[model samples]
Target chain A: MIRSGGLRLDGVTVLLADGSKFTRKLVAQMLAEFGVGTILEAEDGETALDALKRGPVDLLICDTLVENPDGITLTRMIRHDNGATYRSIPVLLLAGHTRQADVIRMRDCGASLILAKPVAPKALYDRLAWIARDPRPFVDSAIYAGPDRRHNVGEPPNGVARRQMDRERFADQTKSSVSHDEIMAILRQADSL
Target chain B: MRKSRFAALATRDGGRKRSDAVQAAESQLATMEGDYIAEADRLIAQLNVLSGAAQPDVEAIYRVAATLRGLGGAFGYVLVSDIAGSLCDLAERLGAAGQVDPPALLAHAQSLSLLHHRRVKGTGGDGEAQLCEGLARLVARWPAATLP
Candidate 1:
C-alpha cells in the first residue's frame, strides 16, 4: 500500500515515453489521482531525450518499445551523461511482456524499477512511493581511508572499492527472467531501418 | 454486414417480445467471437507486409497477439486462443531473427486470414463453436508449422 501521508510530490514532473495514446492517457489519469502536478508526454525516446535536455525531471516512466532509440538505450544515455540533472532520477520501465529477462536488462541499464504492461493503478502508486522515499544514502566514505594503507591492501582503495560496490548493488537490483535469446528475437522483429 | 444479418435473424418468427429480442441479441453476441478472431487474423496479415521493413516494430505485433490470446480464451473462443498463441510464438521467433522472410511470412499470414474468414462465415454450424474447434486443430499442428 502507498503511504500517501507525506507524499506531496507537487511540482514534480513525470515524463512518459510511450507510443500508445491510450497508455499515455491512462498513466496521466493515474498520476493525476496521486496528485502529480505536471505530466509530460513523449511518443518516443528521441523526443523524451530532447525534453530532458531542456530541464530536469523528477521521474521518468518509459515504455520498452519507444518509437526512437528505445527505452533501454535512452536510459543508458541518460545515466551516462553527467550534464543531465535528471541522470540519477528514478526511471520506471514498462514492458509489454512480463519477461524476467526484460526486467533484468532494464535494471542493468539504470532503470530504477520495471513494471509489466497493463499496469494496475495501485501497482503504479506503490512503485512511485518506493521511488519517492528511496532511503539509500550517497557518500564518499573512501575519503576517510588513507591511500598508503589502502595500497598495502590487495584490493583498490576504499573509494574505488565503494564505487565497485555501488555498481554491484545496482546490478543486484535488476529483476528479469526472460532469456537473452528471447529479447534479441523481439528486438530483431521490432527493428526498422 | 454481420450485425445486420444477426439483427434480421432476430426479427424472424412471431417471438417479438422484448425479452426474446434481448435473448436473441445475447446469442448473437456469443456467436460473434469468430468475427473478432477473424478480424485479428486480418491484422496479422497486414503485419506480415509491414514486418519486412528494416525495423518492423514487432513488439506491437506481440502485444496484439497477447491480447487476442487472453480475450479469445475469456470469450470461449478456444480456437482463437490457439491461433493467437501460435501467432505469439511466431512473433517471438521473428523478433529473434531481427528480420523477416517475406515469402514464408506471407504464407503464414494468408493462412491466418483464411482461417478467420472461414470461421466467421461459420461455413458449418455455430461459427463461434467451429472457430473454437479450428483454433484447437491449429494449436495441435503448430509444433510442426513452427519447426525450422
Candidate 2:
C-alpha cells in the first residue's frame, strides 16, 4: 500500500534466494543502496522457506534455478502451502534465459514479476517501485493462484493490439458512431455544398 | 480473488527518493566491478583446470559457467556473459547425453580465459566475435537435449 505521494524503500526487509553467493552479494548491495532495512540471504529454497517461517519479509527475490525446490516451486509453495502470513508477500523471480516452457511455468508459479538476469539498477528500482504501487489483487482459484496476470488496467487505446481477439474487439469497440442529428446535419451540409 | 494490499502496506512507511536510490545502487555497482572481475578471473581459472582434467567434469564446468553468466553482464562484461551462457548450454546438452565433447568444452573454457585476460568488456571486437561465432557453430552442431 504505497501512499499517494510515494513509498520509500527504507525499512523494507527483503529475502533474496539464489544458489550463487556472488549473486546474493550483488543483489544485497543493490537492496542496501535502496535503503532497505534488512536483507536476508538464502542459498537454496529450503533456506528461503526457513527464513520465511522465521519472520515476515517485505519481498522475496529468487533466482529461477535456486536449489532444493527451485524458485518456481518455491513461489508455488508460498502461494499455496506456506503459512497464511507468508503467502501474499510479493515474489520476484530472476532468470538467465526464459524458454517458452519456462515462461508458462513461471507464470503459473505465482511470482509477482520475473526479471531477467543481469538486471540493471534502474530496472530493479523500477520493479520495486511498481511492486510498491501495484494494484493487482491476489487470486486464489482452483488451478491458479498469485497476483492477477493482467498487468494493464484495460486494453491499450489506439496501441498495437496484443492478440488477434483483442484487435477485433478493439476495432469493434472503437468503431466510430454518429447520432441521427449529426448524420442529418452532415447530409444537409453536403446538399448545401 | 482479492487484492492483497500487502505490498503497499509494507512499503507505506519510509524510504529515500527513487532517483537517489538508483544512483546509489549504480555507484555501488561501479565500486564492486573490480571485485566481480577478480572473482570472474578466479572462476575462469577453475574452469580451465576442470576442463583440462582426464574426465573433464562437464557438470563442474556448467556450475562455474553458470556463475559467470549470472554476474558477467551486470559488471559490463557481456562477452563473458554470452560465452558463459553458451558454455552452460553446451555442458547441459553433453551431460544429458551422458557424453563429453572435450574439444567443444575446452574451446569455451579457453575463450572465457582469453576474454578475461584481455579484459574484454561489453561484447569484444572482431576477433572475439569470430571466437563467439565458432563456439555458436560448435554448440549448434550438438543437438540440445529434448525438454520434458
Model 2 lDDT tens row, A1-193: 4553445655678999999888899999998888777899999999999999987787999998888998999999999974478898889888865433455788799998777666667667767767666667778888888888875644212112212222232232221132335323322332332
Report the lDDT tens digits of candidate 1 across residue range B1-148. Answer: 0111112222234322333333433344455445545556556666556545555565666666554443333233334444555556656655655644433333334434544444422122343333334334333332322222
Provide per-model DockQ scores.
Answer: 0.03, 0.13
Tell me the lDDT of model 1 at A13: 79
Deviation in angstroms for B61 in model 1? Answer: 2.5
Clashes of 1: 19
**Tens digit of lDDT per residue, candidate 1, span A42-146?**
998999998888855667899886768888878877877754566666678876543333544564576666765434444455466555544333211322210
Model 2 residue pairs with clashes:
A1-B7, A1-B8, A1-B9, A2-B8, A8-B15, A10-B15, A139-B1
TM-score for all predictions?
A: 0.50, 0.80
On a 0 to 100 scale, what is the lDDT of residue A93 in model 2?
89
After superposition, the stretches of candidate 2 with alpha carbons farther than 4 Å from their true spots are A1-7, A97-103, A150-193, B1-6, B9-15, B145-147
Worst 10 residues of 1 chain A by lDDT: A144-153
TM-score of chain B of 1: 0.45
What is the TM-score (0 to 1) of candidate 2?
A: 0.80
